[model samples]
Target chain A: MSREWVPFGALAATVILIQLVTMFTNTQYYLTQLIMAALYSIVVIGLCLLMGYAGQISLGHAGFFAIGGYTAAVGTTLNLLPHRDHVLVRMAERAGLTIQTTNSWGVDILYFSPWITLLAALLLSGVISLLIGIPVLRLRGHYLAMATLGFGAIIYYILLGSRFLGEADGIYDVPGFGLPGGFTFDGARNNRVLSYYFVWALVIGLMVLMHNLVNSRPGRALRAIHGNEPAAMAMGVDTARYKLSLFVLSAVCAALGGVFMAHYNGGMGPTEAGTLKAVRYVAIVAVGGMASLWGTLGASVVLNFLSLRGYFGSLDDAVFGVVLITVMLVAPDGILRRLGMYTLRRNRDTAPDAFPVSAEKQVQRGTA
Target chain B: MSSELIIQYILSGVTSGSVYAIVAIGFNIIYNTTGIINFAQGEFVMLGGMIAISLVPFMPLPMAVALAVVITAAVGALAQIAFIRWLKRPHVLQLIIITIGLSILLREAALHIWDEKVRSLPYFTGTVVTSVRIFGAYVSPQVFWVLGVCGAAVVLLSLFFGRTLIGQAMRACSADPLAATLCGINQKNMVTLSFVISAALGALAGCVVSPITQTHYECGTPLAIKGFTVAIVGGLGNSTGAVAAGLLLGIIEAFSISIMPMAYKDIIAISILLAVLSYRPTGLFVRREVGALKEF
Candidate 1:
């Protein structure tokens, strides 16, 4: 479904080669580096789904991602259960009705299950997204963009001032659920490689599910809605239902990514969910070409590569802005992906209208 | 909450509400004329504040603000001529995105030019204190000045539209551009004036409100969003409606903090905007206008 697969495969293989080089060159911390990079893959995949398949814009996925990560962190380490509060428990004891805080220090209230918390985060994000999306989505274009942009800001501000959540400092030393708490695991036990494998498995499964979806009747409906809602409605497509569905699904994707991200990072903070993160995520989708999963995945990988290459430390903002502008201009599609398709067609001698090279060659022959 | 506290909150709401109203009015004017939501409108305010901050050291407060407004109004016209005119008149969504990009550029430029220090413009109404008791609640003089400036701007605008030929021509352009053009209206000039009016109003609002919120590069986006929200609540291109929505939103926000948890206070306004928009695209006060009508 994506034209970038060949280039992406080649790129991945090249990267793997580099990894081998570094590994064989008496590398000291290869394991740690690999693990760190792997966990973020899950986040990229989730972002791909939101920005790619759903045709939704979210400047706030980082906030959701942070929430997922923090929930795991806090749940494991500090435990944010109000029920476990000694004062609250004592008050409950005095009262006829009984509700106990799980932990003695008002921390055990949220220690029920990591899986439960993860599910709750996904569900909560989905529901919250639905509520926010229903209204904002009614707006046709940029108005919706501004509204969603605000949604991100509002979430970040809220997180910044919250105390138990540790404000800007973020939760640290978050526990990793390992071997049923039987095997005493160190803080650094779960590195990026563990995160990488987990995220890779998740991404592959999600890609399969999403590929099946976009190729199906429902996918047609989504495209229909995107093309023209009134026309789609005329065609008997339920736009509201579909829009709501995509929104929720995209949110779940973000949340699932977030959940993994939290466990992967051991904690999440404001910087992870800031406006810059959202903008880059949106750019990834745009560079990838909206609604193309492979394009999105490719773009995300490229962005991550660029980040590693000191893009964030120097000239990154300008580079990203330039990239976005160029894509919007010369290639509304992914750069290398589009080039590959054109080249393939040239070899096949299909004589297509879009790849102007074939037409240009014909023109030259006639003129010469 | 005490009566004193309640009155203070109301005063605060009304003051910020006036600022929102001014911003929304600016948004409505440009939107009415061009069908583009100017994301850079808040920069006009920021510009006004920053310029006033720089000028205050050299000039009186009122004079500084006046000079800032003039400068911003000129910049506004240039912005229309330079960037906006060059871009293809995009679909509504594309236009919004363009403005967003412009907003980003403007914000970064502001941060680059002027450091991120919080700058303040002196209050025009002076240091004189005027305390009013509403059920034994105290209100500041700044609120009245905010209300006064907005009222004056609206009246001046009304008179300009009703009395001046150019203003009348602008209105006619907004009403029906093809007809206005057939009647020999130079639409380019009218569009430029629209940008001028919008930017001037935004600058004026910033100058008036700087006594309260101070100035920063970051405040621009929040203010822009508030303006956008108010504009939506008021209905597209409805100046009066935007004002009303701004006031209503401000009051609702103020009361939320008093009644609900502080954490939930800000979220409530967004939730309200979403709730209202999803259920009612027509706005609280809906009016149908010809979609083809160009702007003044």
Candidate 2:
């Protein structure tokens, strides 16, 4: 049991194996979607933490997603009349490269590479989230949910109707990355595969970070807050700080997911940030069990896979509804709790001395 | 903008807002009885519109609307008996999610049934008087009908509650369900009635508004959202407040166009709902029922 190589007996080892097998499955588009689903798992995890552990709800998470996707998309777009602002133009003129407005959309629309644009977008998204969270996260439960939902509507409309994008139609044929070391990528859709892998990596990294977070002292504070806000406050826990932290964290995760989604989908649309979509994401976190990180990972995986498991693809929403209702009925604490109970009963009759390897037990002990 | 244009916009806001206000009344009725918001109230409007439009070609317009109301009322009553009432013991989050899910089911079913087409039913008066000069901008007769219906609904509801046994029973449940139960009132049955009445309001709204805005499968969502916004703005469980807030929202939306884009028009209603809920949290009319806020 103590051997270093025997780590194959670990939970991480099992999940990694499952994820690998799922990634390589014969369902070709399934692999891509699995990766996309994994990317979304990152956001849902933070959402579960916010709504579950912190007892706050947000209905406009896609606002962050829009910001993220737009960051990458518009960054890559290289808008007209932007590379040379007045100050930049002056700087350029002094360097002898004469600059003047060559395009008519005014000065703000012009110039930058995709990566630089992405950074700016991410920074802007973070700033916007901080501003939104400061006032709005002050509200609790349904009120907070309504506020965020409105924000989602506002952002979605902005993305859709703004001429900077394609309006309701949205931008098409967005540029893809080309290798600097002599490799060329042709189609943006083809580039989607690469973005999928990038998202996979990003999501996995986030999961590990989130998993670690929820196992920490702050995580205990969050869980206590969720169980009873008054009790948490009575214990001297700074409820507001924890609430704000979770809000920022969740927004960042969603924004990162949006970046991946935008690139893979080859330009984001207004629908990506709609209330219905945000609700769907929240439902994902719920169906997966807001209490367990693994439940989200599993639920998202299972949900995405089941959606394409048949011909209609529309049946997936129905399936989601069923799963959501059933899960709420069967395991209010989440599917992870059910799994823990099953395994624990099995272990009680089998390996009593071995430590329990379930998230329910870990959280219970941490709370203790 | 011209005064006439301003008047036109205001009239338009009031009419649309009137529909929302009616729906908000429905929301209030349900909330008062059960202490929870029903997200599917909007679907009642959708079903009402879909059925009324479908039957208008063959039946008398009044009869068609009457039939739609009755059928939608049954649907609403059945929804309560089948899902909301049958949930045994539901948490706040769980109940909210259930309502949202039911709403999606109703909406998607309507989409599949109606096939995403938009059509208009004939106006109540069947008089098409376009561009009646108001302040300077012309308004439609249908707008007046909207105001009339909402006003009538409020008065009628007031009477129903004050003058009828069932209405008084409903008030008892709102006041204290346990006490009402001790008084030999069937609280569950009252809850069902609340759903029925709310659904009927939503359906009536659909029929009334269909003549002007037209009806589509997704019309229920905007309708539901507007109704919900109105309810939230007025106060979550206040019936009178809903009607008042609905009128206020209509007027606000009308004048909001002067300051913001037309697309940002509904934004004001949604903004008010959110802002009020956040700032006050208790809603504009905070007459919480005795022990009514307790979770199941």
Candidate 3:
């Protein structure tokens, strides 16, 4: 049990070391992109669990992210002043779930609290994923990919076509999510350091939770399903239920990331829901050793930070495309795995406890 | 709607449907030979149109289109050789990601080669406004070109598959690769040939339909989705079913405009894809028994 905590301890140390180095160099502003990347990493790790462990690929995670972000954006930005006398609004006001704010034109607006919107976002994405997963998870390989792609296209079209959702312009001027003790999550210059630490702390907490989950019985069942669905089923594993639950769980994680990201960025756009974004998430997971949660976190932070920093410029999407192709072609297990870093089981036939073995040792063992 | 208006919608639907059928056929060819859906199939269509558009400025329209088809077919073969040839036995997921990557690369290349502005080739027979009156409705003469070329291509393909030695060898490879190898057929070459044929077919469709639907760098993705939908609706690996399903989808989309906003046009086809995938993944034409016998 203590051995399991070593990686988490090392990760926490690295996070602080990076922060300290940036602070000493007076490059605190770099934390802005890091914050965003860490938030996006949540979605990546969730996808890693689904694709890597559960053996289900989702090409529509961005749709769930958008659902969450849009829910938060719409919930906070849509004014309910005109319907203040409405029973629901009055009830919400009585319940302290509505906040009074002013628009840019100095008009009074009553909006749902960010906490409420966050809840709404999570619930909406969960329900949507459940609905989509039922029929979609039944497919395998290309069919599943296409169905999820289709689902994403539907979400994109809806986002682009709906006026209430702000159409192509998306929702902007979203209010910051207010927390206790005078803390707020937003892109405000003054809140940079706080937001950076806050987001990273959330990510680390999630990592611990995921790490525990992946080592538990469900994770073993998922690996079994990944190996052979029929065999897993014959072994009394409820394959469908496991796959469906993982789908919903990962979708909720994506939506959670979206909610925080929407609040952090102070806006949400339809482009966030695009197929390219979904593909990018998959590419990141692929670049990481798919089943290695640590590898995914590291890849997501570095790649997304670089992308957010405009390092790739106009060639951003192309770079990811190349990475995906190159990784799949050269190292189907993943680049990190090929490099002998963070080696998980080489194949499903190996014992589950044989992970963390160095590549050379594994090779020697194989020969012996 | 007036009867003429309905005729106009049907005509428009059939024209677009023919294009979708062609794209679906492109998917079916490679899928039959390799059991892998080339996600980059639609890029071949986009490349064809883009190449022909660039070439038309230098050469005549027919020559430009023909040369474009040849070039695109070569590109298809090259992609197969460079990316797909050497893998011993790749997983389906790996192939999907590879093809998807290829599609993105091809799209980005098109973007860099041609600007983002939408472009199109001149009509094959007439100008954009020159409409041929057909049964009380004015239809673009190019519509007939699309239908004629697509139909002729299908008929010719059937004949080739039925008569040619190489085509028969490809059929054998698809039927059973081990047996085909025992029969001295090069399975790899058959896969590459399948790609070339589909690419050439996609290019031809792209050129014919360019005038009606302007070509853009980003158009391949939507076309690919619609084509995949048609492919599934027709049942995977079934070319005739693809043609019928494509037309049906196109007509439904064309008529959907009257009931829904224009921006929601793509949603109509995709929703159909999802519905069919859920309810009848074996396709509309395949019998339940036959579908059950085959693995999806």
| Predicted candidate 3 versus true structure: per-residue lDDT over B1-296, tens digit per residue | 99999999999999999999999989988887888888898899999999999999899999999999999999999999989999866777778889989999999889888989999999998798999998899999999999999999989888877799998888787777779899999999999999999999999999999999989998898899999999999988888899999999999999999998999999999999999998888899877776774554
TM-score of chain B of each: 0.90, 0.91, 0.99
Among residues 3 or more apart in sequence or in different chains, the pairs in candidate 2 whose N, CA or C atoms overlap within 3 Å are A82-A110, B4-B136, B4-B137
Residue A1: error of model 1 in Å? 14
Task: Give the Å shift of residue B26 in candidate 2.
Answer: 1.4
lDDT value, candidate 2, whole model: 0.69
Encode model 3's per-residue lDDT on A98-138: one tens digit a residue: 99978788999999999999999999999999999999899
Winner by TM-score between candidate 2 and candidate 1 = 2
What C-alpha lDDT do the candidate models reach, one value each? 0.65, 0.69, 0.88
* Residue B51's lDDT in candidate 1: 79
Specify the poorest-scoring 10-residue window by lDDT in model 2 chain A.
A359-368
lDDT of 1 by residue, B55-173 (tens): 88898877888998999899899877765565443334334434555566566667777878998766565453656666677765676778999889978977887799988887777
The CA-based lDDT of model 3 is what? 0.88
Off by over 4 Å in 1: A1-15, A24-56, A78-114, A176-205, A271-273, A304-368, B1-6, B128-139, B162-165, B168-189, B261-264, B287-296
Docking class of 3: acceptable
DockQ, model 1, C-alpha based: 0.15
- What is candidate 2's CA lDDT for residue B288? 47
Residue A127 in candidate 1, Cα distance off native in Å: 2.8
> TM per model?
0.80, 0.85, 0.96
